[model samples]
Target: MEKKIFENLSKICKTINYIDDESDIIKYSKDWRRRVNEKALCVVFPKNENEISKILKFCFDNELKVIPQGGNTNLVASASPSKEKEEIIINLEKMNQIHHIDTINKCVVVDSGVVVDDLNSNLEKKDFLFPLEMASTGSSQVGGVISTNAGGINVLHYGSVRNNLLALDVVLSNGEILRLGSKVGKDNTGYNLKDLFCGSEGTLGIITKATLKIYPKSQNYFTFMASFENLKNIINFYEFISQQIRFPITGFEMIPQISFDLCIKHKFMKKSFFQETKNYYALVKIQLHHLDEAIIDLLEEKLSECSNLYSEIIIAQNEKQNKEFWKFREDLTEAQKLEGKLIGFDVSIPLDKLDYFFTEGKKYIDDILKDIKFHTFGHLGDCNIHYNLIEPDNLKNNFYDYEIKIKHVVNKLIKNVTGSISAEHGIGLLKRDDFLKTKKNLEIELMRSIKRVMDPKGILNQNKIFRN
Candidate 1:
């Protein structure tokens, strides 16, 4: 970078906040997946929207690209700069703030930099929660959540960030602040712009703040861990809950035998919670406003009657046990990192096609990889499956080779099943080729048109989503 350019950026933000350290720049440029560790020109921390505007205007004038980043926890490499071009990173972690908490309307307005868990913690004071619960909640900021449209375990009942997001405040490429959506519960005046930006992956603009709907905190929870002999029975049990269960089902998660065993082997879980193990295990949890003993008796009796569908079932004895069950599920992702290379396929398949997809998908993986393993799971209620392929540590240079073949086969199967290439994770640089391969010409043109209109110079997060 030229001294004059650095001086100009220093004028926009404090000179001290502009991080030019090579090591730190490399760290900020990398994604959570340990992929694409390219260096950024520099990383700037803007304190407010005005500073961000000035910095963006500066970049636009200089024809330099900008990568707006939050917690930098996305698996698709969206938050980091591409290796093709030298872009400056606009890290938003310094702007963390909770602007308002509207209890009457059950909504909270917060800065995009506020961590999801921190927002939920503050909402707990008013007896409410943000409802978006992910393994990365502790580090993921609200802005990135909105940018990626993150759908976590609670999507069974609460839906994704797109569903909970009420409004957004964004800083455009030309130093303009664009505000979309209203704080009110209902608004149908014109085209919905908030949804367009919800999963934009920061290509359109930089998200500065958000207004999200919050649900009242549940007082009691009924959690169960069950193993299924027949994978088809999992879908059947899901239907039964939808039609029969009265409680709000927050989480219906599927854990394959490999993932369950991996979690234990890595010590992410202290021990096996199930007495009798099967091919797959599921964690079903319901939230309640208050405890009702009859509710417990009804669920227990219901499980006993439906024993034919499942091989083993264990109801959580208390809140501690319930959290333990959830911890096991949450810890599985971390354990995958320690085990080997993981390629996550976040696909949304129809409920009836899950068994077939799993069977056929595993057969293909096994046939090709030969000695590979799978660390896969899903939010079963919404049929959002995370079909992850784990390549062994001894693959060496072969990991990249296997990754290409695996991605090709898995994407083909997803396309055959009429499922989307991406479910919760948005189209980032990692999935750009696959997204373009699956996207229709009309859809691609529409996105291109929107991109041109929003970032005319294409200075914001260049070389992402749409390959330039």
Candidate 2:
């Protein structure tokens, strides 16, 4: 049976490459999750749509499953294969191509596997911006971005990946092509299928291509790093900023002092932006287009009157300094990784309930474990923060062994605050059971029904987004 399956795969993916080597097999076996190991029988690369269709048909006929992968940067282990080894990995990197950028329509039609940073630069050169900027933009692919409906720095203004995607070209589980939505905005169809597949995380179908909406480049953008004595003060400043300006307030990131120290210990920064006097801080962006300095005056006035902000760092005496400030925030993630192995989660809660979630959640773990440290920071604008628990300092220690127990405590805390297990990272295996715990039985049944209607034979990314 194995020999016959490989033979059929070779025929369908003739123009592309196939790797059955030991190292190659191991590379595709897991994602960044590293919590569980999943091995794929063979990894197949298809160059185009026709080749993908043929490969899917072959897998369907043989009663095999295919996990579609791009960049392999998923945090929730969504792209990683199951332990069954009954699946073949389908990588979309070969299809990375931007076919057309229609400036008049304010959209770009691109092949699935294009990198986000590459797309961003391409659009910027043409005086348009894709506006989806994440830490993994250099490695994360368009197909995965669209499938996961990724949210990043600019989500406060442009919204998540789902809001930017105008259309999608998908391949269903039964080897059928689906073209939903279009470059045009208004689509009051029978059902909004594009939205459905945007966050489906490849369980429903494989997104091969997409038409994404772009915005005109912002004329003026400024970044500020403000220090607060506590998380409560940080929340107050957020409320103040939300009410003050109506223009594009692109990003508002909250960084606790612990996470900040982690960055510094790893040599992420040399001369600090502000004096390290407070336990908490916020990195904010205010985008404007005008000749008046009134907005800046108003912002400064608020900072002064609030009595919460300990200090504020406005780097840009000129435009050059502002750009430098932006670069510092973007590079923060890379700097953290240079230090040690990290375990983190993407979580969300109500904006007003932020204080309880962070304070109570941290207290719960810190009380139990005295030696370990947990770092918390993320998009305060959209209410999604990354709660990372760093491994113990000892090199020989195994940090991942405590994942299940730690996650259980955090999940319980989030549930108490009416929050979700996942905010941006989709329900890959890492959080599949957690997601199910939060949803009702009927909701799970509905999702299953949708899967059944779309992929009757259960060939596309089987045993993902749900329990087997």
Candidate 3:
């Protein structure tokens, strides 16, 4: 049956695009986290929208499952395959292309497979930026970012992928093309279909191309790193700066001492920079079109007001220092891998409850799990925390035994605070059950109804977003 299906796919897709080698299948089967690994029958790379349409049409007609993958950098297992080995992976790397960039309209139309950093590099030459950035920008693709509705440091200023997205060209389940939204913006014609698919996680359709909003590059940026003795002080400082400073704050990130220590231990950064580390740290960046004496004076006044709240404050005087501060945050993920087994959580709560959530969540984990360390950090401006659990050296090999209990303890506490279990990270195979547990019955039913309407045969990204 697998051989016959491959033959049919070959007729619609190019021979070079069809890949069934075990090595290639193994590479594309797992996600970035390596949490789930499922073998695939084959991986197909379609070069154009027409090819993708034909492939989807064939899969729908044959009742074969298709997992549309871009970059394969998803933290969740959304882009990974299933355990049955019946699904075929549709890799979109070959379809990468920047169709056009309209500076006057402030939008860029490009193929789905374009890397986030590559697009930003092109836009930088024109003094423009896409504004949706994350740690995985170097490896993540535009389509996957849109599908996941990714949020990053700048979300406090520019918002998530959904905000920057102006339009999308998607291939539906039955090979039908859907052009949603508009390049000119401000369209109230009918139901907003673009939003329905923006974070749909490929359950509704496959995004082939997109029109994204861009903004003029900021001419001046003020970056600073401050250390606090406690999380409450950091929270207080965040609220104070947010209210007092009138300039555009582009980045506001929180990094705990443990995360910083891990990075330093792994040699991701020099320890001499952080001469005296505090309990927690906050990184802030403000972007402006122009910087004047008045702007500088106002920023200085604001920082002085919260001087007592922070123990140490270091402002980036040049571009090199600014990049070094950001490197501290971006290297946290890779640094954690150097430690033992890691279980990471991407969740969001009310802005005011940021300190409380971390305090209580850490306490809950400490009580249940022994010799476990917590490395918590995220976009504190938006209340999203990447609360991760790391196994101790003695218990490194036995971390899996406590995975379920740890998740339960953490998720239950988050629920108590009325927080979302899955924030920017979509409810891929990793968190499907957790999502169902947290969401209301009506909400789940509505989602299922929409899924049925868009994919009746259940061939597109099967068993994702929701459970069977």
Highest lDDT among the candidates is held by which one? 3
For every candidate, C-alpha RMSD to the true structure in Å: 1.6, 2.3, 1.6
Clashing pairs in 1: none
- Candidate 3 lDDT, 216-277, residue by residue in tens: 98869999999899988988998899898888888899888888778878999767356696
TM-score of each: 0.97, 0.93, 0.97
Steric overlap count per candidate: 0, 0, 0
Clashing pairs in 2: none
User: How accurate locally is residue 85 in candidate 2, as Cα lDDT from 0 to 100?
Assistant: 62
**Could you tell me the lDDT of residue 396 within candidate 1?**
53
Which parts of model 3 have CA positions greater than 4 angstroms off?
A: 14-20
Error of 2 at 395 (Å): 8.8
lDDT values for all models: 0.85, 0.79, 0.86
- Give the local distance difference test score of model 3: 0.86
> Candidate 1, residues 1-468: lDDT per residue as tens digits?
556777888787753222456677777878999878677777788889999999988888888888999999998899887863378889999889999999888899999899999998999998899999889999999999999999999998888889898999999999999999878868988889888888999999999999999878887888998898877987788788767778789999999888777888898876788787688888998887677888788878777776788888888998788888888888988888888877788889888887788888888877777767776688988989888877765775656677777888888888888998889988888899999898799999999999999999999888788987
Tens digit of lDDT per residue, candidate 2, span 1-468?
A: 777777878887632212446567777776875655767878888888878888887777777888899999888888877765677889898888999999999999998989988888899898898989887889999999888889988898889998898999998877889999998999787999888899888888889999999888876766677788777778878887788657678999887777556666777666566755677778887888863588677666766676544555553666776665566666666665655667677899787887787777777776655556666788988989888777767646566766667787888888888877788988887778888887779999999999889878887776678876
lDDT of 2 at 148: 88
Give per-residue lDDT, candidate 1, residue 28.
80
